[model samples]
Target: MANRSAQDIRRLNRFEVLRRFHASSGPRTRQDLASETALSFATVSNLTSELIGEGVLVEAGHAQSGGGRPRALLTLNAERGTLIGVDVGETSVRTELFDLALGKMAVDERPVTPEDVTPDQIADLIEAGAGAVLAAAESPRSRVLGAGISLPGLVERERGVSTYSPYWAWRDVPMRDRLAERLELPVHLDNPLKASALAEMWFGAGRDVDNLVVVMLRSGVGAGLALDGTLYRGATNSAGEWGHSCLVFEGRRCRCGNLGCVEAYVGTAGIAETLRALAPDDPLLAQADGAAASLLTGLAARAAESDPIALAVIRRTAAYLGAALGNLVNLLNPETLVLGDQVAAHLGERLLAETRAALAGHTLAQPLRAVTLRLSSLPHDAVSRGAAALAFEGFLNDREVFGPVSRTRGVKARAEGRG
Candidate 1:
């Protein structure tokens, strides 16, 4: 401790204080910070004052949470910086702009398909979407600290490379570097499910719930695990690729070239495949002529109306989904499990109920009893929102690193509208 210089000590203290403030639900007093960060009251007060002068902290309002005199509350200067996040999903590209405090400023999305999934095409869409969102939010490029993108595939996050995306048929693309070049901004990228889990842990359903899993059910099933307060990306960053696990040996073929993987049964694509086996002559398939999109919607709509074939298909998928969840419960024993994407929007409570029933049957009684299953509170935008959060988190950790770049740009976006 004695080896540290005075400036170094103060810098670390300021980081701690500011970090505590950013994580708080609302503005907090120095006394609150002192107690929370285990720093002395005098040190907290001094650091807070310095932050106020630097325009990073502001007196938001007053509260009597500690129950003495009404202490002044402090929060980050929300207007100081911005973050952008992009989600390149199977069907669309979504972009979101957020203030330093993680509040949405503006959003944009456009439809896309597997056939249109080239790096150049996707990067152009992201660039335009970001430009539009920034202008819509009236946010300047200078205030934009950085941007993030999430892919529905394996990501070499350190290299900013998307290793592969089955749905998009994309393989080994350097998405981050390309997008950064297009947007002329610092960029970060990660798996969409991981980003979604980050958002849930940071500000959504899994907040304060350290051990949790967010299961994403789109055309395919993917799970994001947050273990002991951090995302659990395993060796090769493929920890939560539980979808590829074999559920039924040699049963149904999956796009991943495996037979009877969990995703082959529970994913939207998988459900449709299953439906084809059971009711080959069903009207939903005939009505949509076997389109994956129409099949899912038609199935869900009929299931909602208690149509027998649709209900049976859902129940069968639920059984597989629950069996997979039971493995998660027995292995990870997460505090919460969040079902999201197409599954939640379409199947809703029925999926939850059936999953619970099947999970109870597969999992040990004690662990199953302690777990909670929840529907994702995030809208369809969860992945994109999480991506933006990744950028914000990076900037906050080393604001000084990009501080000069941001300052040199002169906050022109605030004064001058989009040119």
Candidate 2:
């Protein structure tokens, strides 16, 4: 939670009004906002007028049937500006463009292998991707309010610095300045998992849920924490490093050279490693030749044919991840646990069933019963989309950058009905 102060109370109140209005099912009148936020109508009215003056919200129109004088409706003004998102994943850079309401307008992607990725190379990819997206969208470059980059490492967002990035081999780089210089736009940077969690809160499976945890399963395991609709990064911004959390006591070696980490047993790469370790003589491991996707596909194929070895591997993987899920449920007791990313793509019903059973067995009965577990219904591009939302949200908060245009003027202009 941000530190509240007498000086910033009004700012915070305006932000709250904007957030509530944005998440609402439709444009909300002052009366509606007051009811939803438990604030007085007078407070909501002043806040909405200020928001309209700032071009953040517009008095869209009156409700069709309010009986008497149709109450004015306020909606987020889509013309405020555009937001850009770049997802720097394990092996690719994806950039996306979005309107104020989180509607995707265009996207572009570039590939970069993890080992060879460098700061300059990654920056080049981001620039190119953003350029491609903007060109495709035919949006004027000046209209882009800002850009956001979601990396796969620890970040110091306050300084716009990436403390460390394992995927791109970067350390203590002034990433925000570099991107801003290249793109000539304001930028916000954060962890991809954080972006993903924000995406879930805004558009994906965790939508409408206040307390939620978004788990990304890829070569490793990680989590995104949302506390009361806010992304909760730990003191060091390493809050979701569940991949590095130890699960086994002196167990198998992890990629991070740790013993008994949960990720070593439950991640897609971890499952592949386990397959190779346990099935040295099996044809499946030989067929995959160490590709994570191929290995998972091979395991799924054999499991489909009722291969005991394959089924056992999957069952064990499920148990480990389920145990990890149990830990999350107990600790956070979130309203939802969302499984997403590439690893989730390979999970079959059998894996889910085993995971569900393990979760039920491991967690406290009450929380387990209350929590809903669901597979991610988001597209493979969720990371990029989430990053875009991060950019949009960052842009919205900095009110100094906005200029005031009175609520009455906005309503009068609307009466003229200009698109």
Candidate 2, residues 1-419, lDDT tens digits: the string is 13433324444445556656545568888878777655566766776777787777888888777487788888988888888989887767888998876678998888777555778778999999999999999998899988989987789887888887755557899989999999999898898788888777666655566688999888657899886655778887778888788888998787677898888888766787777777777766655533677777777778899998898898888888888888889989889888888777776567777788889878998889878888888887888877777676567555464422111001111111111
Clashes of 1: 1
C-alpha lDDT of all candidate models, in order: 0.77, 0.75
Error in Å for residue 4 of model 1: 18
Could you estimate the TM-score for every candidate? 0.84, 0.87
The TM-score that candidate 2 achieves is: 0.87
Q: Candidate 1, residues 34-64: lDDT per residue as tens digits?
A: 7765677777788788768756689988876
Judged by lDDT, which candidate is best? 1
All models, RMSD in angstroms: 7.8, 6.4
Candidate 2: lDDT over CA atoms?
0.75
After the best TM-score superposition of candidate 1, give how far the Cα of residue 350 lies from its true spot, in angstroms.
Answer: 1.1
